[model samples]
Target: SDGTSLEGNVVLPDGKEVDAGEVQEPISDEVYYIAPDKCTECMGFHEEPQCAAVCPVDCCVPDDDHVETEEALLAKQRFMHPE
Candidate 1:
């Protein structure tokens, strides 16, 4: 595995740019929570979720409670990254 850290541009709902490391809420020292509004499931960026693929423990499964259609996921991705 590459030693590169997972980081990227993050935009809030109010159009504020935030540090990627600060995006996920900390549940504990070893656990973090990804907000649904901030997660696009890598729809427009990859064929599948990279998180799930790269997770050593295979803990990045889909959230059935917040299931979204493909179109909706793409739309969210486009909104977050207009470039």
Candidate 2:
């Protein structure tokens, strides 16, 4: 995982140009964002979500807009990464 290609665009929270979909670009002033379709929630990496577990303010709650099952999560992981 040391040199994995993003293969996707890293856009800003307000849809501004940040990384321009490549890692070689210098980071822009725009805040970056990860699309929900690309976010794994750390399912393949950990049992519990490290983000929610280590969040100081406990603001990493589940979103009602984007609900996914365990199977779906795994499938997504595989879909993005065919390795």
Candidate 3:
């Protein structure tokens, strides 16, 4: 293990034991929650996936389930940071 376990456990939806692959953790605004309502996924300011680009371990993966189109993502960015 490279100080990191590829296979690990994440808290499940029902608050029980399950495969990490089966659970979904929300992204938080205060800490990078995507704000789904704010994340342009790095819109107008970045040319790439900013979070993933900055993430040290490259652990940030696109949410296939919470998937949204580019337009939706941009809309979210506007909604979250309406400044």
Q: Model 3, stretches more than 4 Å misplaced?
A: 1-37
Tens digit per residue, CA lDDT, model 1, 1-83 = 01113256655544777665654445578774556775778887898877777889877766689888888888777766666
All candidates: TM-score: 0.62, 0.56, 0.49
Residues 5-76, candidate 3, lDDT per residue (tens digit)? 224553322255545344445665455554342246677568887888889887777766677777776755
Clashing pairs in 3: 27-33, 28-33, 38-77
Q: Write the per-residue lDDT of candidate 2 for residues 1-83, one digit (tens) a residue.
A: 21333345544333554444454433455844334655677777788876777878777767688888887777666655557
Of the two candidates 1 and 3, the one with more favorable TM-score, higher being better, is 1
Q: lDDT, candidate 1, residue 44?
A: 77
List the candidates ranked by lDDT, beginning with the highest: 1, 2, 3
Against the unseen true structure, what C-alpha lDDT does each candidate score? 0.66, 0.58, 0.54
Give the Cα-based TM-score of candidate 1 against the true structure. Answer: 0.62
Positional deviation of residue 79's Cα in model 3 after best superposition, in angstroms: 2.4
Better-scoring candidate (TM-score), 1 or 2: 1
Worst 10 residues of 3 by lDDT: 1-10
